[model samples]
Target: MINGPNFVKGFRVTKVKEFSLTKPKPRTIPVPQKIPTQKPHQPVPESTYRSPKEQEVLQGKKLTNRQKAEELLIEANMEQFKCANPEKSEKTKRVLSEIMREEDNKMAFNKVKVQHAPMKVDNVPVRLNAAAILRERALYQRQVEEELSRIEKLVDGARDPSEFLEWQRQMHARDLEKQLADIECRRLEGKLSREEALLARQNLIQENKKKALIKKEETEKLMRVYAEKRLQEEKEMRDLVEQVSEGHKNTKQARMKLQKYKQQIVQEVAEESRELLRQALEEAQEELRKKFELIREIRAMESVPFIRQTLVDLTQTAGHGLNCEMSIVELRERLALLKEAERKAEEEKRDQILEEKQLKQQHLLDTLEQISLHRAAQAKAAVLRLEEKKSKSQLGKAAIANNDRVTELQRKLEEKMTERKRQAEALKLNAQRSTSKSCKNSYEEKHWKELEESRERQAQLLQYGVVSGETANRMAAYQAARNGTSQAYVMPS
Candidate 1:
């Protein structure tokens, strides 16, 4: 059986033979036997060609949807072409069909299957010449006029006019719908603009919040740094104080001495001891200077950037919104200087007033002293004159003289005595007049003073919120009435 299968397989293999004709001949392509010569140009018959538009449609790359519509119109024109010039339409139809087939093949590649469905041709918009287009338009308008005339005749004769009226109503509804659509469009546009504005505002608010948060963090950091620096300055001041008080820090004796000095400061005030008070004040001032010196040294050690940062911090924290013309510190210093100048001016004015008062007082004291001295000189002169008179009277009786000479001398002496008595009386009268005038003036001055005091008392009462004028008059009237009644009753009839 195996030999039988081998025999059959060998017979099949023997029968199978490769054909020589299936192999391609390895020979070069032969050149033309005769030299090709250019043929003479011959004019093509005009009957073989189509119109320019039909040629363009045939030569176009492919028919897009818009091209397809144009193609359909052009195809429909083929029939019009037959009716107008019947001789050429068959050849044009052949050209148009070939162009359409190529376009359909191209579209089939995009659509997954070839659709050989014939597109219904629309009427060709005959636009080759303006004159022809006008003729066609006039014909179409005439047809429309005839149709409208026929409708009007029917509407006039028929009882029912619902169809025409219904068309008019539909047109009005369309116009109304167009207006409503325009209004809705405007409303939507307004809404869109408002929404955009709201979104922009929200974005701005978020940005502001972010900026505020960052500013808050920066301020907190600056405050922390400032607090640390201030604490360091306070610590430095404390150290300086410790150094200044070191001398008094040693023993019981030194502490006692310092304590005693401080105690003496209080007693110094009671004793009016300016020297002790001044010494204590000078020591306090020295300590204060030491503190300020430490502060200055610390400040001087800081960099310019640190100082500028502190200045910026002060400006922002104080909400000064300072400009670059000057610093906040400069403004404060200027204000302080102005205040100090005003205070100095006020003090100078006060001092000037005090000096004037002191000068007046001194002048009054000098005048009083001069008056007393003048009075003392006058009294002394009077006493000396009296003593001289007494001495002369005692000596006159002891001296011897001739009777006539004595009488003449005595008469001259008596005349002199009369002159002295007359002079003394005149002085007495002058003194009395002066005293009386002074007394009269004193009385007038006292009366004026009392009047002024009464006026001042009334002013004070008014100033202290007392009811005046009408109330006072009423009270006075009531008192007057009571007093008059009492006096009348008490009087004897």
Candidate 2:
């Protein structure tokens, strides 16, 4: 790089060279001035008395600057004039000089004045001046004069002025006389004031007192009539009460009689029901017994050889002849007979079985006795042999034979004992079986009897219209008596 002093020296010299100026030569020439040309004026058309349409356009049209300035000056002048005298802006005074000039405008303005004159004057001050007062007073004087003249004419019957003038003087005197009469009447009225008012008040008070007396008399008469009417009503009420009490007593007695009749009817109904129930129960029992007898008869006939056909032929022949209205007691007796027959039949069967068993037992006993006797004989034989053996001890062969025979006899006795034990066991078993069967039969019979009693009682209760509880209790008692059993009874609450 160059030294700082040298760099500065070169930069300064170049600056002066770049900015160096040369001397100038002068030459003279005049500068021209430009003047703006003014636009030519176009005159506005003169304002003519236009129709309403033309006038509206002229009034609403925009104005040139000059016309605007002129209008502003005119408005300023008018405003200054209004400020100088505010009263002048009020109802404009009529100027005779202006009216006399401009004939058409004056005539138009007068016509407007004639139209608005009353309204304008109405707004003016109404000062009561001498002229107005005089005019009013003159009008009053004229009206009075006309009245006076008419009155004179009427008094005189005048059709002419001469007669009227003569009547005018006379009427003046008559008016004076009338005025004096009115004054006299007013004086008389003033003098009578207190006496007249007192008389009027007395009349009014008398009329009021008479009205009050009449009203009181009428009220007292009405009260007397009302009291008499009330007394009559009380007498009627007392008579009615006595009649009602007598009727009530009769009704009460009748009701009691009716209640007694109802009780009698109820008792009759209960008795009838009980009779009907007994009859129905009897009838049902008879029917059941008859049916059972018929069944037994059929069974018995069937059991007999060829007897069913015989019975059928007999029934066909006798059915129409038989009595249908058999009583329950008769049927029950018949059923009992049948039951006895059946029991006899069962007893006969039992007896037959017992006879058979006894015969068998007797036969077995005979056999056992024979066997015991045989065993005894064998023992006797053995005993005899022993005796013989003892007696003949030297005969040895015979003694040995007797000993063997005693052993054989002992075996035969043991076999017979076993046979007797077996027979006893068989008899015991047969007896036990017979006893159990008899017990079962007895229990079934008892149960059937209880059921039959219950059914009979139910029928009785149904016919009587009594409750089942009472019927059931009676049935239980009846069953207990019949079956030789005890019964518990429960009462209803």
Candidate 3:
């Protein structure tokens, strides 16, 4: 019993409360109400009528420390030890220590305590024994159930095992037929030639044959596996039945009867399955025949001229020799020979036509060459005549409109040369005067201003003395030749 710090205070210490069991008071009974007459009786839900204690638990009210201790004590007593003092017994002490350790672990490690109501026995489902039920059932009902179970097992995960394979085969066949039809359509549309169409058909037939063989093998393997599993299951069933029969040693007649009924059922199912397989095969064959007939009609209606001609030749050449007595291989070989001969003949004819076309083309090319030469000669003569007339006209115009500006040009050149000479003399006098009067500060702004002013005056005089356009152009060309730069030609306005 540990004392808290409050016990040392001057004020009266709060006494530790001791745990005590209190007697419960009698609960008051409620008065019953009379039933209603007109309205329909609605049943109240069980949850609404739950006891207060159950309601408190459902509301997630946690137990206090004393209450938890009381629960532990009660659980300890419920172990039912034979010792006079259960609290002092070794097993009791061990159980209490284990419970304390678990509680301590829960408190120390488990942060979350999920509060939930215990599941009731009424909520648990009752397990049934299938064998017991089967044993109790009548023979006729049992047989029916067995047959149904066997049928369900045969179906497994498919719609019906008997029909699934047939359906898959039919679907595969339809897909193949559709692909063949598309190929034929492409051939008719000229997307594929006759040889390509034939090759595609042959490859498709080979693929179909291979797929059929694989499917047959797969089906055979599946049947073998199924038979093996069935045998194993039957053996297991027989062993189980023998074991059960040995326990009773009196149901031999019933067992024999059941076995005979099962055999009959199996034989009947097998016959029905075979009949269904035969019917599906016949239906599929019939459908294929109808589809082939339709295909033949469409092909005949849409046959190309070349194909029709080839067929006609084949019929005319080999029709008499072909008989029902001939084997397919012999017939095929004969047709192949006829086709080969026809191909050779067609090739020769094509070659002859190509030779004739070459001859005609050569003749036309020679004729065109001669005509082009004659036209070219006439064009050359006409061009020469036109050129002579143009030269003559150009000479007459030059003589009529000749303007002799050489004298005027010479006069302008002399004036420009005199003006340039005066400017040169003035620049020379300025340079000599600047040199004579040059001080240490001669490169200063004042001296620069004077030099710039003289240059501006010289430029003004040169602009005023400008010559005619022809003379200016000639002077610019001459200056550019002398200066080795075109910059002199780009003169200021």
Clashes of each: 0, 0, 0
Please give, for residues 1-493, the per-residue lDDT of candidate 1 as tens digits: 6556453244443576788898987999889799789999899978667576765664563455458878889988764531122344577999999999999898885776556555444665545344544454456557669879878888889455688897996676556555544544454444444444544665576588679989999999999999999999999999999887986666778778999899988896777777778889999999999999999998878844543343244333354565555556777888999999999999999999999989866665555555456557669999998997676545443332322444554455456446545655665686699799999999878766654464455456656767575554454445446444221121111
In order, the Cα lDDT scores of the candidates are 0.65, 0.64, 0.64
RMSD of each: 69.3, 88.9, 66.7
Model 2: weakest 10-residue lDDT segment is: 82-91
Candidate 3 error regions (>4 Å): 1-342, 365-369, 372-376, 396-493
lDDT of 1: 0.65
- Compared with the true structure, what per-residue lDDT tens digits does model 2 show for residues 29-91? 768879889999878755544456865655554334347668889998776531122234223
Q: What lDDT is reached at residue 357 by model 2?
A: 82
lDDT of 3 at 66: 46
Model 1, residue 116: distance off in Å is 99
Output the better candidate (2/3) by TM-score. Answer: 3
TM-score, cand. 3: 0.17
Residue range 1-493, candidate 3, lDDT tens digits: 4665555547786899866657576798988999867988789988777776875764443344446668879997785442122237577889999999999887986577777654333245534344433333344355568879978877786355568887986676556555544443343333223334434555576588679989999999999999999999999999999898788877778899999999999999999999999999999999999999999999998775553343333323444564555555677898999999999999999999999989966765555555456557669999998997687556544543342343343344456446545655665686677677765366465645654464455455557875554555555566546545452333344
